[model samples]
Target chain A: MQFGIFSVSDITRDPVSGETPSEAERIDAIVQIAEKAEEVGLDVFAIGEHHNPPFFSSSPTTLLSHIAAKTKKLTVSTATTLITTNDPVRIAEEYAMLQHLAKGRMDLMLGRGNTAPVYPWFGADIRQSLPLALENYNLLHRLWREDVVDWEGKFRTPLQGFTSTPRPLDDLPPFVWHGSIRTPEIAEQAAYYGDGFFANNIFWPKEHYMRLIKFYRQRYAHYGHGTEKQAIVGLGGQAYIAKRSQDALNEFRPYFNEAPVYGHGPRMEDFMEQTPLSVGSPQEVIDKTLTFREHFGDYQRQMFLMDHAGLPLKTVLNQLDLLGEEVVPVLRKEIEARQDPETAKPPTHAKRLKDKYGDGPARQPKPNANRGDNVTGGSPYQDSE
Target chain B: MGQNFQLVVVSAGTSDPSSTRLLADRVAGRVTTLAGKKAQTVGTSVVELRELASEIANALVSNHIGPKLQKAIATLQRADAIVASTPVYKAGASGLFTSFFQILDNDLLIAKPVVLAATAGTARHALVVDDQMRGLFAYLRTVVVPTSLFASTEDWQDNGLNKRIDRAALELVALMTSGFEKSVRDESWGSYQHEYGSAGGTELSIDLDSDLMKLAAGGSAGQKSAG
Candidate 1:
């Protein structure tokens, strides 16, 4: 099981001060949140990309690449890579490069994105989104595995001969998860390719995510990915935890009520009861999150939307300390103890690359001794030829 | 026998008969042999500082790279495969190479199969390929081949280097010919229109007499629309 935090990059008003963070303050806060995620023994921290107002991350790679140098052991990924809008080639190369820089600790969650204007800005129509997502991802998948690609499609121009470089480290590309909120089409896309399906279960109820997960598992098996249980799965969660349930609710309530995504929509208590959002003690969050496996089946990665809602940097950091110290260790132990090796396999970078390549371990290298001495032979000139 | 693939080698070494270019040629030769009659090769040597100096000294400031450069760029843009070889300088790719990279058409290398090769003085410099070079390519949105063939003088003297190159060539051929063929069903159906989509006209049409008022007032008129 992987434990991580994700942010939507919203600049929120400080609950205590009633003052909103400047864009610069919000950007710096995102960096601090990511650093804290690492300090707390978390395995990953993902940042969402949104180009519109109130959101800061226009370039996720620039942010992730910076994070790659700042921390070790924490895999950085995009909450969404906007498969429908960005060119598949750029995505393939950028992440492949990050995989090398991060030493294989990179993965991406592809989505059609939440904003509609982004489509037209990228010269794509919203109506062709599903087809664009499907076609673009198909091209991206090949780009990572194949050395040369000759692709001709409705969305992008044909390639007579094309090769993306520099190569991936260890001959393996990063793993990918197709993220979906309500669209069965995205789930079907993930299933068709036998890739991981991330059901962002935070917005919907368990029953809704269950159907989506079930559909993916069945179709995953249909595509011969693996047995239903073996299909790679990850879930999304939103939480705000404290040592006591009452304190947690009191602190998070005002923030939640004002949150642009869910604020003013449902009462905090009703929202918590209906969705995967846990606003209470650490134990309560852990327990509520653990029961999720029963509804969606054994999952590979568990991510929480903690840094959203304009929580101050200090509070978010404190929440991470509790989640990592009190929550993740327990989840890891429980998930591991319950896992059946015969049916359950933790997702690994190598496994995903093999799945994508449609082959066994990348071709092995052979040595040649005929060109010996010249290998070490110098410039053959010492200022006198 | 029916498969046709194009090989583009991007070399960034300054010296004529440079080791990096030699290594690039060897890789290209192996591909040519592997693809038999169906393979063609396009090679570009981007001695960056020199190109930049010339561009800076002349009216060529338009970032409008020439036909020869465009032909080399097309190798990356339109080729089925690429073998990019460069000499390591200060523990990273040459500045010349990076500057040329800055001018490449956006997203031209996406999904294209690429083999990375580098020639450095010592194995200690291997990090140059893994860290800096690979890092730069990722920003450009290209899929780098996973298995790289790195050559150091010591390995060459011990006769261990060429063997790796051979293996790289063979494996690269298999990956490109099989996987790329399957991924791309048609070779010439104009899929690249989106990538090479009109980059606005590069033609320099400077009409000083046309309308100075419209040019100067254009700024104010735009603000008025916003008002």
Candidate 2:
């Protein structure tokens, strides 16, 4: 299993100190955290995308590209790139460009953004969220795979002979994982496309995601992509660790009580018992994480939410250190030993490139010079001569 | 031909000997007797919100139903008909009553028969059943019986209360024996929209051939541009 951390990019006030970091400070701190994750041997560092206030990561590709440039081994990605509101054409081009800059050290998880008003802000309707997501993704899929695309959809203007430039690095689109908290249609979409399905397993009970993941796996096999065991799956979790369990809980309680999303709600102890929020020692985190395999079956990736709720940058770095040193090493061994031999590994840039074009030159589109209009040409790019 | 029916009674009373529970049981008992005349055996199950107050509150905060609440929801979903009773407080329905229904899947009670009842300390709150409860159940799309039962302090001594209770029970029985709820749900299931992420609750089946799914596969001919 690949282990990593994902941040919601909340600029929360430190409850204990009553000091909130400035936007610039928080942004720099996240970049530092990403670099530290690589130094500690973590596999991935994903950031969330939010367009509203108190959230710094409205643009995930820019941040991910910067992180990728700084780290060689650690994969940079988005916790969720909003597929509902973003134009699929822009997503195709921007991510393809990022792939070239990162040299294929990137992939993305797509979600219908949680904020409702964001839809209207982007000139979309929340009532048509599912249709928007489904349609946009269909267009995005074609943009990446096909050299030149002719497409029209209900949500966007028509694209005739539109070639999304920078045509993905080495002719391989970044592997996509659809992330959802509760929607089954999303799971069905992921399964139908033979893509990965990621469940935000932190806020809800295990039974909730167990049903979604099980449905995705069954449908993956039903769609003739692979056996149920071979379907790719990922889960998001939350944890806070210290030497003693009490210390961890005591330290995190103040932040837990005041943080948004779940603050002033369920108590920390009850939340931990009810959801996947683990607050304890390194061993406790290990024990809690291992139960995930039993609950959701053998999965490919496991990401944790460690940097949100106004925790300081130093504390988040410490949590990463414990994860890389104590938790992931043991988890990697234990989970791998129990993994079914038929189960597929998580997709990477190299693996996808090899799968698409084995021992052959990858496709490179050369645009025909200055055709005033693309409508007159049979093809937008020149293949030979 | 004799058939079995599931009747669930939800009582949102805070006291141990609350008039709300009394009213619910009275409705359930009368409905069973009236349905028996039509060769239908009614099996009754009661959900006392007073007993599940903490679990309901926790579910509100955590957005997850506990085991006891899940069991109550399951019991309600299996019910062929329902008798929903609540005690009015501060000129409105009890918070416990509204909270329980808020957590329910929107499609759970679609086209199901329901008898709305409310108990208040005074006769002035009589319209709580029609004014408030009917609107709530209407939003859920339940086929609430036209006759609603309201019990006041003096209603216990009035013969009119018994007449209204019997009338409501008769309406519920008539609706149940006709199997109108099941037929409507089966025939017009596609017309009702479901809340997202309700796959585990009332919405167990999905239409794979929906227009959205077709578009996801690939858009229609109009969606393909001419090159």
Candidate 3:
């Protein structure tokens, strides 16, 4: 399994220190964290997008591109890109551009954003989130494959002879993983398209995601993509590591009691027992993560939420060191040994490009220079002339 | 076809010998006797929220039911009929009673026959059964019998309480004998939405031919209009 860390990019007061990092400081710290992940031999660095206050990652492509430019080996991705609010046309172009810049060291997980008010701000309706996500992703899927697209949908204005520019790097569209907490329709959508389904396995009980992942896998096989075992899956997790289990618990308790999303709710001990939030030594974290395969079956990717809840940058870095040096290496070996040969590996840029075109040149669409009205439809360019 | 009926009693009483549990047991006994008169066998189970207080509270915060709560929820789901009794506190139903239902899957009780009963300290809060509990079960879409039983301190000594209980039991048995639960579970279960991790709850399946799915697949307005 590919192991990495995903951050929601929240700026909160350190519950212990009572000092909150400025937005600039948090943004800069994320870059440093991503670089450290690579240095410690982690495989991926994904970030969440939020448009409201306390969350700074409104622009993921910019952040990911900067990280990609700085690192060569570590894959940069989004924990979730808002497929509901963002125009599919823009997603097609921006991600395609990022693919070229990062040399295909990127992929994205699509989700309907959690914040409701963001819908009205983006000129969309919250009630239509699932439909918007489906339609937008359908359009986005077509944009990357088809050179000229004639499309009409309920949410956006109709498109005729539209070509999303900066066609995907090497003409291979980035692999997409649909992330969902509760919606089964999203799972169906992912299975219908033969894409990956990622369950944010933190926060809720394992039974909740087990059903979703099982449904996705069964549907994936039903859709004739592959056998159930070959369907790609990803899971989210959270951990805090120290030399001793007590030290891990004692240090994380304060942060856990005051963190957003789960603070003031379940006690830290109960939450750990109930959910996938692991607070303990490196061995303890490993033992907990290994159980994921038993719970959801053999999966392709595993991402941990280590940097949120106002944990300091240094502490997060220290946690990452333990993860990379002590945890992931063992997990990689143990998981690979148990993985069935029939199971699919996580998708990457090179593999996708080769799958699309074996020993042949990839597509490079040469647009016919500006033909004012694409509707009139005469080879909008000089080449056709 | 006649089959054994599953009756689940949910009592939200805190005291050792709570009037709420007494009311629930009485209603359950009457229902079993009434159904037996109709030559139908009824199997009964009880979920005492007083015993599951901590588990319910933990479930409320953790969003996942413990083993005991899960068993209780499962028992309720398997029930052909339910007798739900709660004590009225301060002109409202007990918080524990409300919280238990809140944690339950809204669709779990859909179309299942329920006999709503509540016990209160005075006759003034007698309307709690209909006013509050009825509304709550209505939101759950349960087929609550019209004759709700309310037991006050004086109700125990009055003959009207037995009459009301018998009337409610008769309605519940009639609904149960009609096999409403079987029809819902077998024939039209797909029509209902189910919460994730709910007992016997399946994934939300979509009708591919529906307008919403068509629109999601990028079908145009004209095509929708044509259909």
lDDT of 3 by residue, A1-385 (tens): 6889999999989999999999999999999999999999998999998999899999999999999999999899998899989999999999999998999999999989868899999998898888888888888999987767888766788888787878788778898999987776788778888999999998766777888899889889988999999899999999999989999999999999888887766678877888898999999999999999998989999999999989999999999999999999999998988888898878887777777788798766566655565442635333343
Candidate 2 CAPRI category: acceptable
Candidate 1 docking quality: incorrect, acceptable, medium or high:
incorrect
| Share of native interface contacts present in candidate 2 | 0.29
lDDT of the structure predicted as candidate 2: 0.87
Q: Whole-model lDDT, candidate 1?
A: 0.70
Q: Provide candidate 2's TM-score on chain A.
A: 0.96
All DockQ scores = 0.01, 0.33, 0.33
Candidate 2 residues A1-385, lDDT tens each?
6889999999999998888999999999999999998998889889999999899999999999999999998888898999988999999999999999999999999999867899999999888898889889988998998877887667688887777887888778888999987676788889989999999897776777887899899989998999999899999999998989899999999999887877776667877887888999999999999999899989988999999989999999998888889889999988888888998877887777777888787877776787776352556568733
Q: i-RMS, every candidate?
A: 27.0, 3.8, 4.0
**Worst 10-residue lDDT window, candidate 1 chain A:** A376-385
> Which scores greater on TM-score, model 1 or model 3?
3
Clashing pairs for model 2 are none
